[model samples]
Target: MRKLAALTTLALFGLSGAALAQEVTLRAVTSFAEKTTYSRGFERFIERVNETGKGIIRINYIGGPKAMPPFEVGNALKNGVVDIANVTGAFYTNVMPEADAWKLRQVPMAEVRKNGGFDYMAAIYAQKMNAIFLANFVGDNPFHLYLNKKITGPDMAGLKLRITPVYRDFFQAQGATVVQTAPGEVYTALERGVVDGYGWPITGIFDLGWHEKTKYRVDPGFYTAEVSALVNKTTWDKLTPQQKAILQKAGEEAEKEGVAEFAKLNAEDTEKQAKAGIEAIKFDAANTKLFLDKAYEAGWAGIIRQSPEHGPKLRGFFSKAN
Candidate 1:
């Protein structure tokens, strides 16, 4: 009788352990194609999470644009169609216009987290988008103008270029005729002369072979790329404390790794682009000042225009304190 009772208790304990070990999978999507470093960093983040989490949490990464349009993924996350998303500020701005402040972030991601900026932005994200702000994977590598021909003077006269929200206003201020083309279409557009140039991160042009059509990179890159990860609030609230800690640790590690990796890739790829005949066009001192000044102004102008009441306060946190 004693032996049978002990065996029954052991069986119950085994069943309980199995139940606790059940895998928790989260579905995720990205705006970038798998070929892009944005998605590569994303994959690394997931790998770290799974390794440390040990089956407590697993993210099932869904396809990119094929799974959902780049602009639509944020909405999908909000509606619980996906638990997480790797999205860009350009698309996320549609859901939370204040997200544009990310473009104006003067400090590093780690610094932002340390300085209370991360939590401040996260609150706005939760309030406005009903989502959790994870981390900025595409860090520090600023956006630059890519052109087929060298840009002369401060003016972008007679240039028709592709633009993302990060630079659309700034490019327009320089007198360029801006064309909005999807990333997948940029190579074809440039090859066939649908557009003369485009603005993109200093890295990742080779992933889509855009560097083949692009010949010159304008110096003094502006605005961080603003690539970020997000989680659905409902999904976030459901996570166990341990599970949440795993994800946050993974995100923090990925954020630091991304900045270092991008710095290396930026130098190596820029050298390669130079070897392949892509020239770095440097503006004269006066034009350089004007270009940078206009870039910052245009970025802030858009933010304030979209959210007059909150823009100044939001920008204050990202910017140097007065």
Candidate 2:
């Protein structure tokens, strides 16, 4: 009788252990194509998570923007259509307006993580978008204006520029006519003269073939470029504590690694740009200051206008205190 009782207890314990060992799989998508430099950070994060997470959790990475439109990734997350998304804050600003502050961040993400800004931003994502604001995977690069026509300075009067939310206000502040479009449409926009130029980071022009039509890159780029990891709040809440820790740890490591790697890629892309016959249109010191001033003022003003409550707090956390 004692032996039979012990055997029954052991059998129940074995079933419980099997249940605990069942792996969690998460579906993920990126905003850019897989090979593009913009998606490299998310790729690395997925790699780290798969390797370290082991049977605890595994990310089932869906294809990049090909799987779903970039603008729709946020909605997919909100509506529980996917478990995770490797998207940019700019891409999801429709869900959380204060997200634009991320592109305007003046400090390193590591610093932001330490100074309570990271948690604050995470809270905003949860409350506003039903998502978790994971670590920023790309932030070391800055956005520059790539133009088909050479401009003497920052006076953008009468020029039509392709704009993303990342620089819409800045371009408007510089007096350019802004034309918002998807990344895939930029080539047609450029080829057909729908736009004379577009705002983009240092490394992605060639990937998008914008370098083929682009003639000049204006120097003294205004604001930083950033892409982040965003997890669906429902998915995040459902994760086991161990799985959550693994994902969080992988994000921190990937963020640090990505920032360093992308910086090197930025340097290489600069040479590639020059080799591709794209010239630089550098602004003089006075014009540089005027240009930067206009960019930031317009950027923050737009943020404040859109998000009356969270805008100033975001500025305080991300910018140097006055």
Candidate 3:
């Protein structure tokens, strides 16, 4: 009868709607410009996860800083205004002070993940930042001082340096008048002589056109650049077990492969920097030891000073990692 046909049609349409509802698309943002190495690397992670997650889950990268400024992205994720984000620890230190340890710690990513380091960080993020620490994508390349003036030693006295939480203590210890500046503002600060130099990842100076202003790379780079991908805890909690497993697998794979990708790019960029006339201050044996020792001491001490209760326990992992 016509009534039976109508009922059947409604049932079919309802089933179709249900099927569409089964697919999930998470909105993600990053703390970098779209053309930068960080974005390039993170997009690859999104691609791989989307490919692996096909029907169940999809990540739509909404955009980078244009969508949400770098410093504000973490708060967006925490409040569920964003489902995911690729953010740096420096941006979220206010949300989770212990996050500074992620950038300052000397342990390699492999060891960090293998030992309890990543899980410890995940717990911290979950409890304090309202996010899940998915994985670290850009940690292979370390940070270096990109300066307009050349210096022979670690004595940064009287220089106005742009700093992030990662290098603030170490640079301050070296006597530099550290100015806290956001990544996007560094260029204007440099051009206006608001800052004499800045610290950045070994591979990304060219991305921001900073190479044009940089004349010297103070060698013996310090601290692994820890750019982490995070998922909003509310969103994470709502995922099906299978979707969670897929995301976890994708994050692990991205972390493993991203290391090699960054390594290759770092070498290429270092060469490009040399050709572009950026001088390197080569460290001799004694200077190399002195520089690393002082840098580590300054970094670890700062972390402990900020979060005494958790700091020593976390730093224990670094010693074990060695």
lDDT of every predicted structure (CA atoms): 0.83, 0.86, 0.84
What's the TM for model 1?
Answer: 0.92
Best by lDDT: 2
Q: Can you write out model 2's per-residue Cα lDDT over 1-322, one digit (the tens) per residue?
A: 9988866976877666446456899999988888688788888888889999887899998978788989888889987798888887778778888888888888889899889988898888889889987777785888899998888877899899998788888888888999887787899999998899999988888887888899999998877888878889999998989999999998888788877888888899999999999999998999999888888889999999999899988988888666
Candidate 2 achieves a global lDDT of 0.86
Model 3, 154-213: lDDT tens per residue? 788888899988888999998999988778899899888888899898888888888788
The positional error of residue 152 in candidate 3, measured at the CA in angstroms, is 1.9
Question: What's model 3's overall lDDT?
Answer: 0.84
TM for candidate 3 is: 0.91
Question: Higher lDDT: candidate 2 or 3?
Answer: 2
Off-target runs (Cα >4 Å) in candidate 1 are 1-14
Native RMSD of candidate 1 (Å) = 3.9
Pairing residues by index, what is the TM-score of model 2? 0.94
Clashing pairs in 2: none
How many Å off is the CA of 302 in candidate 3? 1.4
